[model samples]
Target chain A: MNSEIRRLTTTERRQEHCDVLVIGGGTAGSMAALTAAQNGADVLLVDKAHVRHSGALAMGMDGVNNAVIPGKATPEEYVREITIANDGIVDQRTLMQTARRGFGMIQRLESYGVKFERDEHDEYAVRQVHRRGSYVLPMPEGRDVKKVLYRALRLAKVRSTNRVMVVRLLKDGNRAAGVVGFDSRSGNLVTISAKAVILATGAAGRLGLPASGYLYGTYENPTNSGDGHSLAYHAGAELTGLECFQINPLIKDYNGPACAYVAGPFGAYTVNSEGNRFVDCDYWSGQMMAEVAEEVASGRGPVYLRLSHLPSDTISTIEGILHTTERPTRGTFHANRGHDYRTRDVEMHISEIGFCSGHSSSGVWVNEKAATTVPGLYAAGDLACVPHNYMIGAFVYGELAALSAIEHGRSSSIVDPDESQVEAAIDAIYPPLSNPDGLPQPQVEYKLRRFVNDYVAPPKSATKMEIALEHFERTKTEIARLGARSPHELMRCAEVSVIRDCAEMATRASLFRTESRWGLYHQRSDFPDRDNARWFCHSILRKDSAGAMEMSTRPVAPYVVPVEGFEFPTTAAGDGEPDAA
Target chain B: MPSVLSRTEVPVSIDADLCVTGCRLCVDMCPLDSLAIDPETSKAYMYVDECWYCGPCAARCPVGAVSVNMPLLLR
Candidate 1:
């Protein structure tokens, strides 16, 4: 037993203790930390990057949609919108809870000096607003939200360690005790003991070529490495909704800027590859891509825009309508708007329509109060599965996670730290740091990315997924042999571990359902129908004692909404004509 | 007729703050000898009449603070 044990006495090791340890300092993590600290708990926020630019902070247009609008909007209306958007797959109870809490979160954020944009009418003039309950708040430009949140955390005296990637949660029996991670700057192992752990890490982008295009270049922040989901699963937390992945149709190739084309104010037509217009102009009235997806799936076309030649003023007006910064120059706009022609060269065009799960919906399942099955553990942001539609819902979920964590921390009694849990965490990571093997880190990442992108991408088939699963099992074995040259490299290894774990969960969930539902990126051709009877419940994945991935199913909680006198316009339409200029 | 000699001319100038020492290679390379090194600042100062915004000075400035803006009418 003594001979089998390998420990590094020479390497630097540091330990810290806190009431709450929040991982991944993106929107959700930062907000959770801020909320927890403000409620008078000592919190430590950890992130993989030195900067806190996660997906929501980097790519979000700064729109916060909450059910706070006056007049006709109510929490019920917001819940209905989500259920309608999700095709009745969303958990209405969770959706309503999030909607009810959304406005208060925004108001709290405003109190922190995070200014939202307002209209000339002196009311918030955000793009998406529901009459009774749903309203959108604008985010400031170029990562200001992250900076503001960081400042707020600093003011609240919340401690943070950036550039440290959390590899896994340290568990004492079924309860979370702390987390084990590596410092990117020094390549040192740092462990933190905490009373409660909140996984606020943002969404996972399946490992692949960075999504780039003619109009936008490497737009999505590369940091969404899926560490939170992987850690939670490894720590024996139940994960749900891995099958539902949202894809944004408007992403441009070549890493150009993302134009707000989808947010076009009503009546816009999406054109296909043959330069022909498709999609029912009225269906999913606000979000045109839902109809666009149907058109593409039916083989009607790969869409593009077609419009009559426009004068200079008309071109500018169209650019304004599309919320594009640059005017539609003959060369730039034509190339930017034309995705159908570009997607043919998969290698050249980095941007593909609906390539990713649109939102970070698949994660550790938590109660309505954001508590996981595991005691002393909580999740928020894209990391926690709180049933709602994609991006719009994630913002509200982040706030809910933070608020729920505050409540959980306050009501719960403090327990002494478990030495065995700390020892176990230390033992698990010490091997990688001490291993002398010189392994290339990027190769591991490339292998993981290829495995997910090639095998698990949308429009999946059972045979293809099975083949991919075989490769994934092989890759999991290969990952153990991977060597890290430095601390940052060690974090990369941890990231690979997280991604592999997430892929395993995603694959198992995709396979278990045997049916295609919303965001069917991993669709199996064998069972094409939406099997509501057999697979209505959520697929849950957990890790066993031997560190093996396990899978199961759990029933989704039911909730009913009062949907009466919901006045939706029937003939209301905007100009559907594409600008030809 | 007894000819009066016709000469083609250009103009050039530079800012000291935009220039640094151990540079000014552009002053020696100008074919028309329109540039001169300011000994105090070790930057290239140009004679406007003989200088032109030909981009050689801006390209050669290692610090990249030098710029040449030409009028649209001149082009």
Candidate 2:
């Protein structure tokens, strides 16, 4: 493979057929591609960036938690932890199955040569603890994890194409057979036909912020413009949990690039404008400074996170306790110690860093088998919402999704779509390429971002959401006028189309559920309180006749008792047992 | 490929008041050994060719004065 291949420049229509086509080469996508290939399926992994820098890769290798200790933890115990953390909104069956298979997944990761921290006793260290069932762990930075996973994908010989944007799913009746997308560099339409399609295309955070809307460069990896969610929805897959959105609170406030002094080494506390400590002081003890924004958001302060100095030994003690190998030196720490720089100085400064638990929680709803309502199409990772009370539940569910998809692919026969279905999807994009007077790509994206952020973001009230829906309805009319000058521009237009579809669905779901629950920030003043008896059901959104959004409710899967006790050690932290680090 | 532009233009400056007390924290943290105090200015100056834009020096400037701009786009 020549690394120096010149960037593609012309529109070349090419097609590749495979047994499994996995969109988005992030953590879950990498795992899915490898698993399918290992199971004797030809796999095609596509990503928006030239590199495999999806959300998971960018965030570093995450804390993989499982109950592996003898006598201290069980699958049931793990399930209880997730349910409690979710505040009764999690799907119990999916939670248990993910917990039960958590160890096997870690073993798979270890087989790929990804090294985890170990104790001085030469045993795998367990660093995670459960607080009221919310499993939390220390995540090493992003680069280390990406290197290990890239190696694993290479070892499996999975074929991948970078800078390819999947615009829509090619469907056969109700099942998904393939996807149609464009190569970003060369303005050409390309299609990948497959027997099964797994959407690992991560979250929709970028859809909310305008400046960083490009798939990899923006607030998110810019590439994650909710194409997978939109593709699945348009293919008639039932989308759930679109209402929950995560807001990352620990972002750097403007005060001249966050001094490594305040955030990195000094262990400074975040205070709001009025200078009050807002976050739960005792919780997040190790990263006590990290939760400053979240504490303020829940109405702890008039503004959000502000920094305060801590004792000199506080930083060193935390580093020593976490056994950090790379620690900041004293001289480096001293330079960043000034308080004169305030929030008004930087571009997109983060006054506080608070992330909505929703980003990890909401997604396409899947069953215990990791199968979406639409057959042959599966979702995993942050894209699929498998109810888990704890944060570490995502790693567990990612493994479960891989296993379920592998099983589904193996047992079921592959069905290729007829020519007409592919033609329909091709026709949707052909007009933009053919027409002389089409609206530019940037204009379409600007309109799409404004509509979603205004309607779908936190502080989502019924009136505001209704107004957002009206804006989306009007924007759909404007889509016909949008044009693309190049392949990349065409893909952006298609991406905005998908975002419009998702935003409309999210609005309908938000409107249907009147009461405030987990992730639905207290925007709706009237419908406050977690009404378990009345609003406990999962809000399922689907497209109805005439292609309008429709909403319905369904009961959450009940928790089942395990046949035998799987012994796992419980940490002093009390939520559940940690995985063999 | 031959370098697109033959010579790279480099920018340099010094703040004498930044080192009034003669502290050497900036020199100690420079991973590339690029900075040295000039006797004339009594302040740190980059050796130009040896500098790496790791940004540690700028981040560690005690009075929050040091600033460096490296134009290599990693992309």
Quick one: best DockQ, which candidate? 2
What fraction of the genuine interface contacts, i.e. the true contacts, does candidate 2 reproduce? Answer: 0.00
Per-prediction TM-score to the true structure, in the order listed: 0.73, 0.71
RMSD of each: 14.3, 11.8
Instruction: Write the residue-wise lDDT of candidate 1 on A1-581 in tens digits.
Output: 12212222124666777888888776667777777887787888887753333344532243454435545266777777665555454456667767676666656667776666666876765555332233555543312455567678788888888667777687755677788776665656677777778887766654443432111112234456677777777777777777665344442332322332223332233456655655443222213444555655556655544333334455445444333211112123234444221232111112322112224246677766677778788877666776443343554555566666666656554455465665665554544555547445556666666666676666667776688778888876667667655554565566676667667666677777787666444356678776666665566677767877676665544446744332222432322211121
Q: Write the per-residue lDDT of candidate 2 for residues B1-75, one digit (tens) a residue.
A: 111224544322446666544766566454323466778777787643333233446555777656554322211
- For A1-581, candidate 2 gives per-residue lDDT tens digits of 01111122113566787877788777677777777778787888888753333443442433434434323366777776555544455566777766676656656666766555455785555533454332333334322565577777888898998767887788766677788776765655677777778887876644564322322223333456677777777777777756654444322321122322223323444456556645443222212323433444455443432332444465444333222212222222222443222322111122211121223356786776667787778887667776432223445554555666666667555555465655666656545655436776555667667666655665567888889888888887678777665554566677777767767766777778787765333234457555665666667776677766778776654446432222121311222111111
Model 2 local distance difference test score = 0.55
Q: What are the DockQ scores of the candidates, in order?
A: 0.02, 0.03
What local lDDT does model 2 show for residue A104? 64
The TM-score of candidate 1 is 0.73
